[model samples]
Target chain A: MDHLSILENKSIFIIREAYYRFRNIAMLWSVGKDSTTLLWLVRKAFFGKVPFPVIHIDTTYKFPEMYAFRDEYAKKWGLNLIVGSNEGQVAAGMGPKKGSKLDCCNELKTNALKQIIEKNGFKALLLGIRRDEHGIRAKERVFSPRDDNFKWDYENQPAELWDQYKSTAEEDNHFRVHPILHMTELDIWKYIKRENIPITELYLSKEGKRYRSIGCLPCCSPVESAASSIDEIIHELETTHTSERAGRAQDKEDAYTMQKLRSLGYM
Target chain B: MQDQKTKCMVIGLDGVSQTLLSDYIEKGYLPGFKNILDSGFRLHQMDASIPDVSSTSWTSFMTGVNPGEHGIFGFMDLRPGTYKMFFPSSKDVKAPAIWEIIGQTSGGKGSTLHDKYREGIRRPLKSVVLNIPQTYPALPLNGVLTAGFVCPDLKNGTYPESAYNYLKSIGYLSDVDAQKAVEDRDAFFDELFLALDRRAEAFEHFMDNSEWDLFVSVITETDRLHHFFFDAARDEKNPVNKTFISFYKKMDEVIGRLYARFMEITGGQGLFITMSDHGFTVLEKEVYVNSWLREEGLLKINAVRDYYEGIEFGTKAFAMDPSRFYVNAEGRYPAGSVKGSDKKAVVADLKDRLLSLEYDGRHVIKAVYGNAEIYNGPAAASGPDLVCVANDGFDLKGTLKKEGVFGKGNFSGMHTRHDAHCILPASIEPGGRLHIEALAGFMLDKLLIQKPQRR
Candidate 1:
């Protein structure tokens, strides 16, 4: 077996475990390369069918091409797609500018997610979060349970060893299942190239810069690269030393803000 | 009891196996370890992880996961979809170490929360890690961090920059000059003892200086000493054996002082643990994996004679260091020869041949693991399709420069999968069979408590 196949098998096993474990589970689809590869793995895990909802949190600030890609694949795959948004907050002008950036993120993304979880009663949410994407996420478990009020107790998390996950959530608090938590950003692009996973054009080099990681259009920027094709991206990542999240504005807000957002239930 | 501050320490002795330790203890040469045995729960015999390379084993120990999970298989890994080999750094590790998962304190050791960049500060450090492998170019750990073997140099290996000055002031050496070790034995021993001496100083320096919940320090001299002087180091009559015993005595003293100080700091309420990434054994023969493959008509090469650079259209399979193998699968590589359909049979046949391999009337190879049998992760795709574990005394080498299957190298010792042991607090018994990765969970279970108040 090849390295990619081993990765695929483990991911497929995790996806199957999620399917078997969670009663009301959904996958968070960011339409990025990582999440899309995750969606492909999800499909592959269930033998070409995603048994649970594919939830896309439309912050109303995402790249336009992302929305187009989402709709195209969602329809093509016959997905049980759930497009969510902070529409109420967006209507009241909730964004990075309203008071502090952290507060705005909480209002726009975390609060919106909280509302969706409550409305849909999602007991567990599978995210495409990879440890290499951010410093804080490095500590995340394959199955991370949120405390009451959706708080992430980062200082103390449960011990998940040998695929034995003690998935006990606080009342009304859901579990965050990261199927790709152990993957690096490089692994995602490689997996994408291997599986032919669909991704937004925003990732491809435009002029000279390409977005390494995508979040909201306002907070995300691109790095200087000529990696227009998937092969080039893989080759570039082999030598590239810069972080994937370097261009994320929210990350620049402060080193601690990502932890703060995560604690507040933000992805 | 309620007022006892939480604390724990993991002392990583690079290659001192339970077998070796038992021999040393029988000679009354390891009083420090003897004390640990009398006090704590000795694991008797904990197996090393698969492949049993120092980097992968320590990584498994730290992350509580196998190579398939933590994504570090050996000292080096081939870049995905390319034949290019890259050193696997701590950054390449996909899973978090216990320190990473526990939330690091702000790099600022004493900065008041309200007065500084208030953006992020984790639970005030509960840990200090020093001289551990796969931790080169040390991450900005919450507490102090000084990396171990394969650390590029003194500057890049130590973290927080503050620790760098202290290291520089004492002229602390991070690792032995490995190249120098091979070329000059006398110089190697001198550098080795100096580095060992400084390592203890650094450990003492940090433990005395830093406040922590957990403290870890791994000594790598045992591994290096065994590698160069394995057979002689054990023989009491050998001239260099005195130097070896002297070094062990020095280490025993270091361990004694460290345990005493650490226990004092912990107020008798902490876990003081000791372990090794893997064990050491005599290197009777070195098996050149690629050369063996070429002889078996499995691998073909061109004039360059390099594994990747010399490959041509006719290549069927190849080998990587520490006994990892890969097939030339098309669609995965640009000019890969093997199609996806024949991969299973091809790998299985390869495994069978490897298992049957022998030299000097001895089964040179103990086991051949299909990547599926050993690993399960995304990076596993990029790994060698097959990993061959050699029997004791038969070291596996990936050097394509060798002319035959059997050869002798300068190395006298090689890594072993058995004999790796650990000592944990007596209160914690992980019970039944155990591997190196189990210790991480044991320590985690110890620290599992009411959440630390958020900064």
Candidate 2:
């Protein structure tokens, strides 16, 4: 079979495996191309219906376009959407202006996710994190176990050789499932185009600028590209030397910042 | 490599087919394999994937699943619905690998996230894995690991930060540079032998250092040797024949030593399995899959843009590497003009024609499988409508740009899915004719290896 089929099959298998093995499982949707493609895979895996709830960690600092896209697709896909926020921190004015990018992300994204996990009692949370996206994420396994606090131990990942992924979370501890961890950014875009998957308009080029990596508005930046279409974005990824997260402020703080944030429970 | 043995060890001899090994064993060259057979250990012909490649076959061996389940069909796969290609890594494997299952039972959520919420590090049986294909950026297994082919760097391929230093201190080379091999023939042999020696040493060191349940190490030199000097092994008069046999003899010695050490360590009670992903044969012709499809008026393209971008609408069908053919039905391809109702008919017609394809009176394709027959999973929607399994001598090539339909090309050898040899202890009966997937269950069953504990 073609490479795409292999990639898609493996991911769907992982997602389905998680579906059967883990109870109280929810998918983390960032509403970006990768996660949207993941949602598309969920639909494909489940035959047009998303059996589980989709958790959207709304930091409230997202691009207006992102929120709009989220709402539209959530309704269109008939999604059981759960909006998560660090309401306590958001009320206390915890954001970029109050702290560093990593701190803000922790308070807004990670902590919000932690709260939602506790509130929903989700045992396994499916994510769309890919290995090629960043160095810190490159070390991830398919069935990544997260503590109740939501931190990721990048160093001591389990040995994953066979098709058998560990379903570690029992009763209360958290487990993060990345069905698309093997996919590259280019592969995501290609899948997006193939499935005709939708994304926020922010990714499309406007005035020769496109959001290669999408995140909260204050920290996220677009790159110079004329990739007005998914096809174009895919073409550009073939030869581009710049990392996918080049425009994200959290990454630019320092090389180790991502590793640290990840260690401290940051997505 | 490691003289110390464990309870269960998988010795992978890549590309050593039934025909070649049997022929060599008959000549007293492969005494190690012969010993296994003579000791009442049966060599089951493990059926690999249709377009058997190391990446997929090894994965099947470790995962106990087909490509449809594991999702690794070849060394490189095109991005879904796009013509662009990407090499799949270990993370791409959706199914749990043998080592991962072993690790899962052991404990420690790979993510540090568990450190705060979870208590205790559960120690399962340790698995010292080495040089398995498609396993890159190795994660911490129960024991140690050094990844195999397509590993870009030693540091990235090794688990535990210190393994890199160990490998580096020993002057270990991951793989032989094929280009340099072409430039200097003698240098290639030196590097090949040296890499093999170092890999053996590293595996030995890890095995000796740790007490483990499962140990697997693959020797990929057979594949490399076959790719270049396959004809030499077949032709007795070739200058490289003696050299190839000597190398095979060296392999026999290594395996002999490993077998003896394994017996010594396990007190002759451990299960030792020697297997290969696929067998090797001489490449007779290179059949350009895409160009052939183009000839059949299945694809329409213009050269003004890139290969993928060049595809035009009304493209009924197309093919990818090593015999993956897709019917461009509506809702699948962006510019697809073929109706969904016509897909089966198109696939049938394509299969009929493909089966009839002949090169100089010899059949090019032996069989054409519809997706429904081969793919038995939810991800079948993404697969090719038909898979063209080529005849033994016909090396199927998939490139928009090719010299011709079927003739001489780059390599001297090709991969065959059938006739792959699997040597396991007679105590573990694999029912009858076994496929690569059965090896996993056998490894788990008779070996008494279990997956990681669920909680």
Candidate 3:
């Protein structure tokens, strides 16, 4: 098999294994290229149907285009979409302008996801985090576990050699199942082109600027690129030395902030 | 200005240390190295990878990355989540090698090296890589390659398929019979000399016949010789001392011949690099780290077994060959006992205990490094939690079947990380500490940056 097929098969196997093992499971969808590709993979895995609910922790700070795309894909893919938000934090006016990006992310994203997982009692939450995204994320396991407090103990992670994943978690803890952890940004684009996966139009070049990575509108910025199509994006990624997350504001705060953020359960 | 052909030649003498080479050169035994030294090549001491094994060190050298980036921590690694062991081959290397970096097309984009050459049109460089360790079952490249030690089959070891026939017809011996040294010393020397002759012959053939911008060949018989006959090589009164010297003299002649050919090919303008993967020293004691861990109650084996399957769930930490330590933490191992919260304390306690270890009133371990201190990359998480570096004269082994903490093995020499040697052309000046990993980048810069000057 080719490299993409191998990656797809591994991801599909992990998704299937998580489904079989977890009592209650859900997948996180961010309406970004990576997570959208993952959403496509989930449908392909279960034969044009998602077996579990797909959750999106909405900070309400995302681009309107992102919300539109998410809503459209949710109906088109026939997904049991669960939109989660920390209404109390939003009501309190917690945002990037109010405090540090770290605190903002924790309040809107981490806490919102915590509430969803707590309310749903999900034993596993499939994520589309790739190792090549960030340094701290690079250290993540295919089956990572979070504590009852939703803390990621990255320092002492479970050993995941070859295909063996840590399927079991302690009581009150949940596994952050990363199906596409091994795929790189380039691989995702290549797979998206090969599978003809539809992505948000915001990713394409608009006046020589395109979102290489999409998050809340206040935090993520667009890079200078002329990549209006999947092929152009692939070509751009092939030659670009800039990181996929280089345009994100939170990661630029400090070197250790991402590690600290991930440890506190911010994906 | 656009016509000068830039070429680079790297001669790897496995296990030849800086101190030993200097001493031999002073004694006029290795005239070939002396000639290079006379020809304005500066000898710099280089640091090998942690644990000082050939597989990790050579991989580090070739890929220009640490074990963390390359994902080859040692020769043998545990099949993660299990006690089963498997050898990490070239296929397991996570980073692009020097050759791969120079050989890649613009279409192959994901490899880390391609990012550097993105601005310009890349012309793939042809290389002749022969007998470099850890490169077994040769992968397809824009060059001819024959893998070095641990290469089980000749047909599988050679690339391009046609080179295999040429090698076979030339009676190329991949490696010498190390076992013969234990059975009969005289026959072992004969085998060693024959292997060296065959290797030199093959190197000469490639130097003359192959069209390569980068040529690399390693003489690995030196490492085998040092492992078995290091004492003889060092001592004048030993029985095989003369034979050992003769072997080096013969190797020196081959080096001279290769150097002359390199000069002819490049008109003395090309970059010529000579290096060893790691140095060697006479073994004072073979320290079994696992046995010490067992004695200290940190490790528990169910019974005497050949493999790590004998380890029980209660084991806090275990080791693989040559001082790679891993914590048997919960969720990592099938029945790991150490919890995530206690992993730091366990590793700390183990490090302290290892640092304080003494053998015959001498400290066995020189330094102990945490994973974060030495390694920084994607693959760091999969490496050893704590890598123990041994002091001189103490050879650290991770063998589980060993009966005691310290004993003498068949080997007279053990690998040392710091004394590895590199001889570089005087024109290039390295800024700081010379590491085995940096050589690949140096070679890449010299070869790729010297693109034909446009008039």
Candidate 4:
């Protein structure tokens, strides 16, 4: 099979596997390329419908367009959208600008996600993480488990051989499912183009600057690019020396910034 | 005192596919490896996950679940119906790993790799790990781990002073230029294999210093080397060079070194597991998915303006990526160009056109759907408005041109679904099946000063 179909088939298989294994499952949607594609895969897995709640951790500092689009589509798509927010933290004036990059992220985004998972008692969470996004992310497993305290045991994980994934985790059931970890940035864009997956306009270059990654507006920056079209983005990736996460501020805070955040149950 | 034996050393090579390894081994190019395989397990074919990349596959090895159950899709996800990126590591997953379970059952988070053996301070069974790809942020365990190649930037070229100099003296990093530094085929391989030898030496140093459970180390040079050299191996015009052969021989020596060290330390009683992540493949052609959308009329671009004028220009005027397209209405698109009837017709027409167009050389589009039809779950709305898949090898290419030659253009080789990159896992004991993901924690857990009962 060609790359895309093979990718699709494998993702579908993964999604199906998650559905069969998890008793209390939820999918996280950041409204980005990967998760959105994953959402589509979920539908395909269940034959035209998703069975679990879609969780969106509202940091409140997100771009206005994101909220508008989210609300409209949630209603239109009949999505069981669960908007998780740390209203306590947001009301206390917590944001990227308020504190250290690490602390702010912990409170607004990471902690918010952790809180939601706990509140809902979800045993498994489906994520749209890829190995190519960053160095640390590359170490992630397809079905990675986290502790109740949300500590990721990077040192000790399971052994995934063939398709026999260890989805059943009794001790720390905070497991993650990654379907498109193998795909590169280009493949994602290609998949998005072929599938017509909806992505943030922020990713598109506005006057030669586009956000390679999207987080709170204050934290995410745009990369220099002429890639206004999906085709252009692909071309740019082929020749570009800059990494995709180059524009992400959190990654630059410290050498192991991402790793530290992740170890504490960040994502 | 009771007799104590040495534990085996297993190196988990994530993203290392056998598909590429067998090709090299079959060519009789990796002679040193032949000797190493003399004592260890060598699978002619090792399977990986669909995407065959790290995130999903590694997790599969760690948790032993399918991608769906693990719920990791891509690096970033969109909030349902919107254009927001959801980072999986930050907000997507919710699973516990075996080590965490073991630690919990035994009490506490265990030890950090740095804390356990900092400054090369080796205790009994003190495992030392470095450059295993995909691991990061440094886990506190009973072993010393320098994370992996992707471990941001601790040091470049030279080894960390905190690390032992055994490998450096033997020439792991210093002996040969890394694959990234060497473009010449022969030189690259030689550098890599020499580096692997150095890697083995480092493992030996740690093994001899410590007298305990598990000792593991990964050589990323193998995966890194294959990525570029796979091309040389396939093309006769660019045949494998002498340096490349030398590197393979060096790898064999490294393997031999590892076995020898194990024998010296523990009388050859410990288990030795060696494995790789996803395999590799050569790119046959490049598929520009976007350009094909225009060819199929699934993507319509406005003639006047080239930009995607959000609400101003109508969605019908242009198509986005494989995700979705926008329809221009009066206030939506930039110029208010497409009006009432035209807007409706454009949306309807585009939908019909996409559903009917022949993406494969012959068959018409079978199914065309927006986010609502395709995905469900919290993030479903954030997904693409429309999802389409062409036949195998006929994946959507984003080029604007209608059609052209297959093997001509941008991408030389790539990874997609179907290519399940195999990973040989590390084992704690001898005569047991090993899973790749369990590698990190396995080394750490094995090195624990106090043995913890399995959960």
Candidate 5:
């Protein structure tokens, strides 16, 4: 078959395998291109039925546009949406301005996910991480195991040959299943165009600036571009050597910041 | 004369093993190989990638990286989070190929090479890559590319749109029909010869027409011949043995012609390398791994379906195609019963049992590798927990539909990991382990720049 079919088929297969294997599973939706595309694939895998809950770890620091996109799509897609937040931390006014970006991400994003996962006892979580987004993610596996403390052992990981993934983890531990780990920024855009997958307008240019990679409002920065449409974005990716995560503030804090964050269970 | 531009040519004979090629060369059945050997070519026994299939092996070859780095494990991979199977294409490959590296270094836009070219320090490098497997839906580069196997059609497979009509005009065939081979042997033989001739024609056409510094072409028909007629090729007494021998003889002639053209092009100064993705062996029995898992009470199935969707929840351990095993741990699967503390014991027990398995008074499994022992890299985490390499003649399969551990199928040959062949020039002495993954870097060192060490 062609390139896109191969990618779509493999992703669908992984989505199905995760559903069949995990009992208390949930997919993470950031209301971004990658995660939304992942949601679309999930629906397609189950024949327009999302068999499990979709958790959005709300840091209360997202753009208004992002919240609107999430609410609209969740209702339109008939999703069992669970909005998770570290209310204790948010009540204390913890944010990027109060501390280092790394610490803020840990308090707002990672702690929120940890609370949600613990409350729901989710054994596995489907994340929409791609290898090309960041160097640290390039070392990630399709089925990455996390310890009971929610720490990732980047070293001493399991061997994954063929399609046989490591689904076994220690007690109180869980798996972070990344179905889109093999995809690139270009692949996501091409797929979005091909499937006509709906995405937020923030990705398109407004006055010659667009958010190439979307996240919390304080962390994300827009790049100069004329890509108002999906086709133009695809073309931009083809000609540009700039990384997809170049606009993220946390990534620029240090070279090993991403690795450290991931090891600490940051998504 | 010694300062002429450096060039390289790679002739890939798919599934041509060093042992079998040596035997045939010793018997004077392949004069072209013998000529290459006499003319300063050193033959090395190379190892194929784990789960030694064309998709993984060839990707490893082109990318100069293991399956873990390249992100293509086999011909068929289970989609993440699902049991459904899908074929991985060129789009799934994570590592950049040697040609792409060459293209990037040869004065592509926004590259260091472009800076060098602006100062008139160097010229752009061109390449001609033909019929390399896993290159379907060929991407653009500095030169021409015609994808190998798994190419659905020529329209999408050939780059530069013009290459398509030219190839069509020359009647180039991407692959010989395997179904036709099964239905009629005579017509199949004719098709094989015709396909080889067309491949040679295309290779020669690009060699003369395209201004290229690197040229690569593979003869996949060798793999097809070995699969169906391995017994006949090995046995002189078989009625079709002569036909098999004749096919090799024709391949030898084609090789000789290509070598001559390469010599003329480079004036005998450029490098010409020959290799194969993996080796071939006679299939004595098809051993079903999942059947054994079921028989040992480690696996359970609800139905007799061909895929993993039939796998029952209570299953503790299961397998996928060609001897890949997974543990159904408590937190890993919905109905998994094996706890974290019991996982080590389960894996040990499974390995011991698999090694002890015997058929016809002979041991079936050669070795069993843990994930840590064989693979390394980011994608390695999703790899098979246990990979079993079977002894010669015992073709291990992971199909769940089999009723028993032992069975036979239509094919007569299976893939061998250790006996794959590579013929490099005597001047280039390779060090350390020899694998298909290292060949791309080796070629890169000869033709252009060195590939950076893997992190």
Candidate 6:
């Protein structure tokens, strides 16, 4: 099959596998291109109906446009929306400015996410993480599991073979599910075009700059680019010297800075 | 004594620590591991061979030899005779793994002529190799494979069509962000375990549906996590922290699930082997080696108009700790500036000065290891003039950070020559630490049941 078909088929398999393995599962919808694309795949996997909830961890710091897009699409796709936020942290007056990037991330993003998992009693969370985004990412497994506290044990992971994924984990804790771990930037764009998935406006270049990665507005910066369309971004990735996360402030703080933050629970 | 013939399904944990595991197990935190230990042997420590890198350890594990004999050294080497960084890959391994020796002779499909044949066939055995370091540009083995860290481009590897379909079915389209998602990762290991589960399921499915003798897989998630999450696991205030205890426990669950699936797929007919390339240790501080070199007069350089008066022109090159420099001898300097005899004297003096100098209120450079002392022959000749093993926590500063500690963009945490960034292998054999090299050997031994002469 062609590359797009190949990608479509792979995502379908992972979704189906997750549906079969986990009784209570949800998809984290960041309202970005990756999650929106995941929404499309979910629709396809379930014959135009997402049988699980689409969780949006609202840190309350997302751009205004994100909410609008999320609401519009949640209704358009008839998605089961589960919005989560760390009200305590926000009430405590925390933002990207208050704590270190590491601290801020944990409080605003990871804490909110952990609370959601615990409160809702989710067993699996479908994320849209791909492996090409970072050096550390290149070392991931397709079916990774987390502990009770959501700590990722990199040293010990399951051996995933072929298409048959082993999704069993401990009693009731949730597992981080990545359905599109292998597709490259080009492949994602191709599938987006093929499926005509709706994306956020932030993806388009504004004044000759574009956000390669979408995060809380304060911490995420736009790179110098004019690739407003999906195709242009793909071409930019093919030729650019900069990394996808180059605009991310946290990564620039230290070489092992990302590691330290992630070890603690930062997404 | 452990039976040598019991089958093993080795799983390599890139940077695991036996000490760390023991500490957690003692606390009764890791139930999955507690179960494994209850049933199998729990050796306290597995002595890792030298040069403790992924490729060297993996090579040694498969060949039952040290990096010295296998010819696979550190991550970067000099191509033959040049002073450059040489990365070890499948191309650099010179010796025949036990798999090759057995696979070739059994079915007459492989030959001793380590040519195109070695690159094309997985020998006469059926193996599934995934994410093993240095096995990039995956040789067309008789089984399946997903290349390791240096596999140039990961998307191009020969993954099953179903793998891609799984990505699409989950609402991830082929977009830049989606593609970037898979690529951009940290020690966020839960996702990695998921990947391994998917891979293992496929492997087990193949093992059950088809007739395959050897099944092998490697995961990079552990190595990535140790580099990133070690602190988070312990950080009480950090919202995203992962404790060292919880991390291994999570992995244990995945391992447990993997074992169950393997048993179901293979009907308990296969052995499992698990291992790590090396082990990991926590770093406490960073010592800038270059700063001390500048302090001593062994090296010469023109400081930015602020420091002491600029030194006269001389031959010198700067690197991290244990700063190394040489007089501009032949084409680099004016003739008679430092005659041949002076060159020898300078070298000797510089060596003594470096060994005795201190930096950062500490003995900056430890005992200096030369090629003859630390490296050997082809490998040593291609390495740095002197391999400086800085004191613990001392790291070599980049060229940009020339002035002092905490340069404008300097961030600390680094790997040492002996830092325990390793894993515990997954094998069906007895419970013990299996080296990365033994992964291949174990696979061959199980697949080729009939003992045969070496290829």
Q: What share of the true interface contacts does each candidate keep?
A: 0.00, 0.00, 0.00, 0.03, 0.00, 0.00
By TM-score: ranked, best first: 3, 2, 5, 1, 6, 4
Q: Residue B115 deviation, candidate 5, in Å?
A: 20
Q: Give a tens-digit lDDT track for model 6, residues B1-455.
A: 21223344666666666655666677776776666566543433454444455556666665554454456654434344222223456656655554444345323322232332344444365445556665644545545555555444444443444533443344321111112122444433445545555554554454455334554556655655555445444456754354445556666776666666665655665555455666655444444444545555333544422111222344343342123333434333332135666656655666676666555567655656543564443333333445455555544432312555323222223333443322223334534544443345445445445433446
- Number of the top-ranking candidate, with TM-score as the measure: 3
Each prediction's whole-model lDDT (CA): 0.76, 0.76, 0.84, 0.56, 0.81, 0.57
> Which regions of candidate 3 are displaced past 4 Å?
A1-267, B1-4, B105-114, B117-121, B304-306, B450-455
Model 5 residue B110 CA deviation (Å) reads 17
Error of 6 at B182 (Å): 17
TM-score for the A chain of candidate 5: 0.92
- Which portions of model 2 miss their true places by more than 4 Å? A1-267, B1-6, B105-123, B303-306, B449-455
Rank by lDDT (best first) = 3, 5, 1, 2, 6, 4
lDDT of 2 by residue, B259-365 (tens): 87887888887788899999888988878877887888888866434455456787888776667887877876666768978987898888888988888998998
Residue-level lDDT tens digits of model 4 in A87-136: 89889998767644556777777789988887888889889888888766
- Per-residue C-alpha lDDT of model 3 across residues B377-410, encoded as one tens digit per residue: 8888989999988998998887776788999867
TM-score for all models, in order of appearance = 0.60, 0.61, 0.62, 0.43, 0.60, 0.48
Q: Once superposed on the true structure, which residue ranges of model 5 sit more than 4 Å away at CA?
A: A1-267, B1-4, B105-124, B304-306, B329-341, B449-455
Where does model 1 exceed 4 Å of error?
A1-267, B1-5, B104-124, B303-307, B450-455
Candidate 5 lands at a TM-score of: 0.60
Determine the backbone clash count of candidate 1.
Answer: 11
Tens-digit lDDT track of model 5 for B166-269 = 99999999887775566688898999999999998998899888878889999999988887778787898988789988988999899889998888878898
For A1-267, candidate 3 gives per-residue lDDT tens digits of: 999999999999999999999959999999999999999999999999999999998999999999999999899989999999999999999999985576788889998998998898899999999998886686889899988877787766878777778798889888999999999999999999999999899889999998888999988888899999989999998998877765443343233332322221111
Better of 1 and 6 by DockQ: 6
B-chain TM-score of model 3 = 0.96
CAPRI quality band, candidate 2:
incorrect
Better of 3 and 6 by DockQ: 6
